[model samples]
Target: MASAVKVLLIDDASLIRRLLGRVLNQDPLIEVVGEAENGQEGVELARTLQPQVIILDIEMPVMNGMEALPLLKKAAPKARIIMFSTLTESGARATLDALSAGADDYVTKPSNTGSFAATAGQINKQLAPMIKALAASATTYPSIRPHAEPKAAQQTVPDADHSWLTVTSDGAPEIVVVGVSTGGPQALQTFVPALPADLEVPVLIVQHMPAMFTRLLAERLDAQSAVKVGEATNGQVVKPGEVWFAPGGEHMYVTRQGENIVLTTDTAPPVNECRPAVDPLFESAVENFGSRVLGVMLTGMGNDGLAGSRLIKSVDGYVIVQDQASSVVWGMPGMVAKADLADQILPLNEIAPRVVDLLSTPRNRK
Candidate 1:
């Protein structure tokens, strides 16, 4: 028989522990090997059990997640730790810090739904898939990816011998649209700040995140980047050299009105099960800029950008994707590459510089 995924649960509340156990036990392949009520106990449990996955809550007694994260990492270096955080500004900031400190990902803790049974269902809804995906990834070592994938951990660009659809295509780019999720916070920290301040086009992004977290991410990026970064506001005039992120839980779209392009946000139904989805934004860019748009798909889970990328390709708009080795989850970019929709597949470090070089190429204007 296959070995079950050993899990360690760490949260202050006894109720949460019991509820987590209820759902986790439902999965035949997952076994909750240990439970702890505080960071101090959690660290002890991790050192002893050496679980495959750790579900850690941010706020706790005897030591908070912030204090225990580094220690837990030290105790079990190979474990995939998923932080449980409240959906608030401070929580968002702390969660980002956890990610930087090597936490794999996080879950926004849901509010009480009156009864323990109802809340258990809610928790399972969010936690089940996340834990399963992480476990599967952990079981297969990073180096053991499929033959079609490039070195997933490598940071270098793929060889030039590969057939790429674009070196520099005809018209100068009028806009850049980015779709990223999962490892986006860290990836953006490195990538966005590297772009030139005097870039000739506006850049818009859709990052799958919550409300307070999106704003905090924008603020953090703005502080580090040469180009100003801000969360997209409805009816704002999309200006050159600025970076605008779609506010979480809303759908942001771009449209040309007269001589100026503008952004609009709405509470529309989600695409690919994400509110701030990549498809709507990419489709809008295709409608507005056509061949003058650059679509970038970065590290994320699921095939959120595949349709959008296909639409972009149909319009002669160029696309670039983060290669498998450097991605947190290669789902988005992998789909694009397999579909032959991407013009360039670059590592994280090479993407920004390539953008500048691509735009620098001479264009023939009508």
Candidate 2:
């Protein structure tokens, strides 16, 4: 039998603790080994118990999640820390700060206390799966490679595996579409900075995040990157040298407007259970750029990009995916690779260069 994953719940609210415990204990694979009402106690328990995972609340008494994050890591290096944050502007900022401080991933707490059953369902549907996956990664440490270049990629990576996909067609890539989740914040921290300042292709990204979180993520990435980055606005012109992000709670797409490519956003129904799904952006790229789109599927859960990549492949558009070793959860990329659709399977470090290399390939299609 698979051993239960030991989890420590650290939240300031007793109600939240009790509710979360109720939801988590129901899962046979997860065992709530301990509980703490503040960060200081959480840190102490972490050092002593050394559980496989920690669901850390960002806002807590005695010591908030952000302040206690580094210290907790020092105490329990092996425990994967998942931040619990409210769906607010300040909460989003704290969540990003926690990620910078080395927290593994984050999950949004219930918006309000008005709904219990629905909130519990969210915990079950979202938080439980996240805990299970993180614990699995902790048990199976091979998902992280210790020797990867650039500091951010050194954690949670597998052995390097790649293949340069080839296609026989004449197409000029005008834009790059990126999709990532799970380890996305850290992954983008490195990958975006690696991109050349004079990058010719306009980059659009969809990172599974909430409304304010996407804006904060863009700001963080832009601060470190040579290429300018920002949240995508409705009907903005898609130009070179800047990376645009699909704002959370909306779907972003691009259309050719005479001499310019115009970007647009919509609150369309969630696709593949995600507000800003990769398929729509990838499909939009096909509509405007045809076989010249470069679709990149990064570390994320589920198969959001499979259908999009299939469409891209059918039109001879190139698709590059993050290798398993470099992914926190290789679900998105793995799905495309399983279908034999990816043209290049690369580590995070190699993806930007490969994009630059492909951009330099002269269009000679007949």
Candidate 3:
């Protein structure tokens, strides 16, 4: 049998630490190796224990999680770190900051911890799978290569594995729709900035996050990117040279109003357990743009985009995905790849350049 995943918990609250420890230990695949009350202690214990995963709280005295993050990384370079954050505005902002600062992922603390059993159940359900995924990926997965310049400016054909995808788009892409989760913030930080400012097609992204985090992410990415980036709003006109993220807690779609394609949002029931699911956006894109869709699937934890990718391909729309070696969790793109839906499978750094290449290609406009 595989050895249990080793985990270290760091939080200021004694009750939280106790509850987390109890719940995590109950999982047969997990073993709680240590606990710390603050980042300083966490860092020290990280050095000694070298646990596979570290769960660090954002708000703590005597060295907050953010302050100790780099230190913990330095002390235990191989360990994957998951931040524990609140579900408030500050928590959302801090979680985004942590993700950009190299934290693998995060889980929000329960707002009402009034019932020990309920809180513990939430922790177990939310945290254990995350811990296992992160730890397994860290120990068994290859190290992520630093983002670098695209190797070639010219468009490249799909690899032999994708030779079955003989059909190609008949027209230059009119819109780019991206579906990402888990490691999305970090991936988008590498991707969005690389897109040229004069891109002729608007880009729509669905990154699984809460409402505040999605808005904050758009704002943050816009600050760094040459192209305009913001959260998608109802009735906004979709135009070239801008990037829009689906706001958390809502599914964003596109509709044709007269001659203009406009963005739309709805509170429809969650698909695939996600409010801003990729399927709805992809399906809507196909409906609005027909064969002019370009679907890009980045690193994420589940197969949310698989169905959408299928829709894109059925109409000869192009679909590309982040390759396994470059993914934080290969589940999303892996599913599409396995199903032969991707026209191209690329690393995070190359996705932007490839999109630009595909968009620039001279194809018949139908």
Q: What is the lDDT of residue 219 in candidate 1?
A: 93
lDDT of 1 by residue, 228-324 (tens): 9999889989788899999989999999999998999998998998999998999888777766778889887778988888767765667888877
**Model 3 lDDT per residue over 101-147, tens place:** 99988988876677888987788767898888777764343433322
CA lDDT of 159 in candidate 3?
29
In angstroms, the error of model 2 at 268 is 1.3
Off by over 4 Å in 3: 138-168, 362-366
- The TM-score of candidate 1 is 0.87
Q: Where is model 1 poorest over a 10-residue stretch in terms of lDDT?
A: 148-157
Q: Which stretches of candidate 1 lie over 4 Å from their true place?
A: 1-3, 138-169, 362-366
lDDT of each: 0.81, 0.82, 0.85
**Which candidate achieves the best TM-score against the true structure?**
3
Better model by TM-score: candidate 1 vs candidate 3: 3
**Model 2, clash count?**
7
lDDT of 2 by residue, 1-366 (tens): 898889999999998888888888988999999999999999999999998889999877889898889989999998889999988889889898888778889999886655778878999889998888877753332333222221111111123121222333465688899988888898888788888888887999999898989999999889988999999999898678889999998999988989998889999999999988888988788767766788888988788878777767766777788888787777788777777677667888988887887787735211
* Displacement of the residue 27 alpha carbon in candidate 3, Å: 1.6
